[model samples]
Target chain A: MIRFDDVHKSFGPKKVLRGMTLEVPKGESMVIIGGSGTGKSVALKCVLGLIRPDSGTITVEGGEGRDRDAFLARFGMLFQGGALFDSLPVWQNVAFRLLRGSLKRPRDEAKAIAVEKLRRVGLKPDVADLFPAELSGGMQKRVGLARAICADPEIIFFDEPTTGLDPIMAGVINELIREIVTEMGATAMTITHDMTSVRAIADRVAMLHDGVIQWTGPVGQMDTSGDPYLDQFIHGRAEGPIEAVR
Target chain B: MTGVLTGILGGIGATVLGLLAMIGRVTIFLGQTLSHMVRPPFYPREFGSALLTIGWLSLPVVGLTAIFTGGALALQIYAGGSRFDAEAVVPQIVAIGMVRELGPVLVGLMIAARVTSSIAAEIATMKVTEQIDALVTLSTHPMKYLTVPRVLAALITVPVLVGVGDVIGILGGYQVATGQLGFNPAAYLKNTIDFLEPLDVISSLVKGAVFGVIAALMGCYSGMNSGRGAQGVGRATKSAVEAAAVMILAANFLLTGVFFSL
Candidate 1:
């Protein structure tokens, strides 16, 4: 389980996360939905230790931050952009952690593992030999997904997993994400504004606004959540309390 | 007034402390990188690319610069020596000078300009684009995976660049002596070869190794510490080149003193 308790983080005078608290349990898929710049990504980064909060305790399984490497080992992350190494082939990128030691076997063995992971994400074995630049947006995301699960991390964090793809490709990626979460029995925390992805992949959904979680419940109840902010968000209405840019 | 002065002093002290802390972190990271290199998970592709950079790709420019410099040195030595009725010593002096000093220094600067800038720009761009963060997410440490290979490659290959530079420099002097200065080609060749000793070649190669370390370290350190935005990357590349060049020259002087103090 992951828990953030009264987390208060600010960048100078601009408070990004204020008294934020949430918990995600084992084998659960939680998606945090919010408009742009509402600190959704910052929340994920805080969990990953990319940024530290000024005041509050972030604990995993009722334990304080300890054994960072051990903790990090259980976490897999898919960044907003598919940040693959341009110089390496797709196979090396996917099998990176697997080949880190005397477990660093021969090229064939590493490639085989990479191909298996790729196939799991619905990618062809031929794609493993190509560079990331040669792949399309959806294909790269598939490769990114394959790489994230290569180590079979216990907890996975995905940032905007369906932002740039076409509706059809997005649906495919959503299905793949759902299937993988089920296949590995892994807990997932995904942050996206795409309600379609939330509907397809989320077991429970949370809405973040004004630097705090406004509401959270099962995906089936989000439409009738009746909370002003959640209603304003899901219906894409700019009038109620959400301010317009103008 | 006193309180303001104290605050300013405290700020300066904090800045110094920050720099010292950074140095400590870099030292720890360096040790980790060295350890990782000897263990498993070596990337031959990264090493080969760096070798092509710090050694082979840099050769043509180092050669061109050294040859022209050697030719010019021969002419200048001939002109300067004639005043003392010592023009005959040009071949020997040019050979020793090129091997002992200019070859290593020029090649060091060349590698600093070409390799350091390129490395700094590449790494800074990576930092800005979250590629380093991506590596971490992939369960790979950026220092161990990205930095160690390039540094190890530079350490091994730059001495070879220096050795080649030394030879090309000598040939340049030979051309001037045989073609322009009307010296006996065989005699000039004999003087050039016979006047040099083992220590000269060793010192040149040693300088190459030290300069290589300074160049790669400066590049990697500045790049890793680069700030946000494209402007930050531009500054990092500039800083890396300047730091590498200055450090190389400083190292050259120290190595020269140590090598020749006998």
Candidate 2:
């Protein structure tokens, strides 16, 4: 589980996260949804310690600063843009953390792990040797997903996991994320504006607005939920209390 | 008058703050890079690429610059010596000049032009494309994974470039003296060899190392601090080259002073 308590973050004069707080339990999928610039990504980044909050206490479930390294060790991430290294082959990119760090396995074993992860993400073993530029957008996204889960981490963060995909491919990725999260019994936190991805992958949903979590509940309650912010966001309506532009 | 004075004070404060931010960023980058350097499974391919960029590719330019500089230096020294009816001093002075100052400084400047711009452009492009963030999500530290290997390669390889440049520069002097200036080849070579001291060679190599570090440091610093758009990348590349060139020249002057105080 991950917890944020009164987190405040600002970039110069723009305050992105304003006293935001939330909790995500272990062994569940929590998808954060919001309009662009509503701080969904910022919230996720703070949990990963990528961006520190000005004033807040963040911790893994039942653990504190002492468990930082251990906590970091138990997580993986898939960024919105498939950030593949142009300089490395697909297999090497997937196996980067496994083969090139203080925690290294043998090259062959690392390759096998990368191949296996690729397979799980519905890619051929042959594709592992190709560079990212040679792969299609969908294939690259799959590769990114494979690389994220390659470490077999207990907590996974997916930032807009299916934004750029067609519906069919998005559905495939959504199924894969669900399958993997359940298989590892890992806590999964995903941030996205895509509602189709929400339906397919989320066990629970949270909506961020004006730097606060405006609503959060089981996915079943999302449609009938009374919050005007939730209604405006889910229906993709423009003229609500939530302004279209910041 | 008071308002103008206050405005000047505010300008100074803003400059101080900007410098502080830049300093803070560099410190963080170096700390992370060192951490990655020590705790790596190590990427041999990346290290080799860095070596090729900082060392091998830099050689031709350094060599070209050095050779021409040596020829021009020889002519200038000869012309000055002729004013005293002592043109014979050209060979000795050319060798010492190439070994002690021009060899390292010119090679360093050449590398600053080539390697700094390349690094800054490559890294800025990576940032723009989200590749660097991908490294982070993949559990790879970008500083260790990207910056450290390049920095270490520069530190280790640029001195070799300077050494090679020194030989080529002295050869250039020989070419001009024997083929163009009507001096005997054998006598010019002998004078050059006899005039060289080990201290001169050591100082030249030391300058190479310092210049290499400065070049790489500027690239990484500017790249990481780059803004979010196309214009941002351009600015980063421009600043990286300018800073690298300035720092290299400054370091050369300081090194020369340290090696030979008045």
Candidate 3:
């Protein structure tokens, strides 16, 4: 389980996260939904220790201050734009963790595992030799997915996973995320504004607003949650509490 | 008068604060990078790549610049010496100028233009794309994976490059003087060989190493602290080249003062 307790983060005069508190139970898929620039990404980054909170404690699996390297090894993340290493071939990117540090494996074995993961993510074994620039957007996303799951981490983070894909490709990625999360039984936390992605991948939904959780419940109860901000956001209305101009 | 005074004070204060902040940040970054250098999980592959990029590939530019500058210096020195009936001093002056100053300074500036900008742009793009963050997530330190190897390679290789530059520069002068100016090749070579001292060569190599460190350090520092987007990468690259050039020149002056004054 991962928990954020009264997390507050600010950059200069701009307050990004103001006392945000949330919880992700073990083996659950929690999708955070919010309008643009509402600190959804900041919240996720805070948990990952990519961004430190000003005056809050984030406890991961009952430890507030675990060893960073060890803690990071347990989690895998898919960035918004894939974030593949442009200099490396696809297979090298996937097998990066396996090729170095305490988790080092034989080069051949690591390459074989990378190929397997690539296949699992709907890419051909031959695609492993190509650089990230050679692949299409959908293929690059799949490659990013393969790299993320290559380590078989206990926790997975998907940041704007289906943001730039076509609807069909988005659906395919959604299905892939669902299948992977279910099969791996990893605690998945995804942040997306796409309703289709939410419906396909989320067990529970949390709406972030004004640097706090405005509404949170099981996916089925989101429509009838009786919160105006939630209703305005889900229905994609330009009016109500959230000013469209800002 | 009061308003003008306030404005001047505000500008001066802001500049001082900015300088201090930048100094503090660079110092901290240097400490972190040096600390990572002594720790485990060194990447030999990355180090080898850096050595090739900073050392071997830089030879062509360094050679071209040194040769042309040396030839031009010989012509200028010969012309100037004729005014005082000291035309025979061309070989000695050309050799000392190439070995003691021009060779190292020109090579350092070339490195700032080429290697420093390239390093900054590459790392800044990686940062913009979140590859640096991804490296952290993969249990790799960016300083170790990126900065240390490049810095170490620069420290190891730039002195050798300076030595090569010095020799090529002297040979260029020799070619110009013997072939064009009707000078005896053997006598010119002997004059150049006799004029150059061990101290001059040692100072040149030391300057080369210092310039290399400054260039690589500025590149890495600008890159790791880049802002965001394409504009950020461009700014980082520009700032890195500027800083490296300035620092190299400043270091050269200081090193010269220290070495020659003694």
Candidate 4:
């Protein structure tokens, strides 16, 4: 479980998150939907401490302060671009955490876990030895997904999980994410503007607009929410509360 | 005239402030790197890889630069000494010049161009791709995983590379003087060996280590703080090499003054 209380973040003259507050309960897949530059990524980064919120408290599992190493270990992230280490082979990228630091395991054991995770993400075992550059875009996303779930994290964050993938591949990723979250019973938070992904993966939907959550409800309620911003975003209309021109 | 004076003064003031801020940031970065050296999670594998990249792979370029410079120095010294009827001094001058100044300085500059740029570009690209953030999420410190290894490798191996460069440079001078400059092989060898002092070699190595730290630190600093996108990476790489070269030259001047002023 996570909660952001009055999170306000700004970059110089640009205020990205203004008095924004939201929550994701345990074992729920919460997908945040927003148009470009609406601070969706910024909000997620704030919780992860990649970007510090100017004024706010983000509490995870009921505590505002936790050991950074231990706190980060409880969660995994799939970056927008997959963010695989190009210097490393696919297996090493998946086994990165286990190959070093406090979570280190034997090389063979870590490789085994990496292979298993790759399989879970619909990747062949042979794909484990190739470099990230050698993989297709969809394969890279799946590899990112595999790496994210490698540690069996209690929570997982997916940032634009299906961005840059074809519709069919995007659907495959969405399905994989849904299956993983359900099977692992992990709390999930994904950010994207892909309505197709939303329908496939989200248990609950929250629409971000003007640095605040404009609408939050079950996935089924998303269609009839009637909030102009949410309706405009989900419908992909050029004219509405969210103007095409900033 | 008054407006021009004000404009120039304001520009100078802003430049000075910008320089001070940069220095402050670099000092803090160095302090963080040093502190992490003593912390847990030491990464020997990364350090080893850095050694190969920064040290072993750098041999060809460093060797070529040193050899050519040494040969050129030999020819100039012979020509200059001939005018004074002191052509015999070629070996002594070449030995001192290569071992004391040219060897370390040339090697340092070469590393700046080669190793520093590579490190900056690689790290900057990694940052652009968000691999750095991934490292953080995986419970790893990016500084430990990335910066510390490269810095440590440079500190440990640049001196060794300098030593190798010095020998190769002296060989270059020997080849030119004996094979082409009409100097006797045995006599030139004896002169070079006798003219060198232990302090000269020590100073050269010390300069190598210091220059190594500067080059690698500048690379890592520029990289870690790089802006987003491809252009950001390009800028970080260019600035890193430029800063490393300037710092190496400056540090060399100060170090020379310290070592020889006595």
Q: Which candidate is the best by lDDT?
A: 4
Clashes of each: 1, 0, 0, 0
Query: Candidate order by DockQ, highest to lowest?
Result: 4, 3, 2, 1
Q: Per-residue error at B130 for model 1, in Å?
A: 2.0
For model 2, report DockQ.
0.44
- The top-ranked prediction according to DockQ is 4
Error of 2 at A212 (Å): 0.6
lDDT for position B178 in model 4: 91
- Please identify model 2 stretches exceeding 4 Å from their true place: A62-69, B1-45
- Candidate 1, superposed: residue stretches over 4 Å from native: A11-14, A61-70, A102-105, B1-45, B197-199, B257-262
Q: Which tens-of-lDDT digit does each residue in B79-118 have in candidate 3?
A: 9999999989989999999988999999999999999999
- TM-score against truth, every candidate: 0.87, 0.92, 0.98, 0.99
Kindly list the per-residue Cα lDDT of model 3 for residues A92-176, writing each as its tens digit: 9999999998688999999999999999989989999999999999999999999889999899999999988999999999999
Q: Per-residue alpha-carbon lDDT of model 2 for A3-78, expressed as tens digits?
A: 8889888989999888888889889999999988888888877877778799987778746456444556677888
Please state every model's RMSD to the true fold in angstroms.
3.9, 2.5, 1.3, 1.1
> Which runs in model 3 stand beyond 4 Å of their true positions?
A62-66
* Candidate 1: residue pairs that collide: A101-A104
Q: Residue A95: error of model 3 in Å?
A: 1.1
Candidate 4 at residue B109, lDDT?
A: 94
Q: DockQ (Cα-based) per candidate?
A: 0.44, 0.44, 0.80, 0.89
Is 3 or 4 the stronger prediction by lDDT?
Answer: 4
Winning model by TM-score: 4
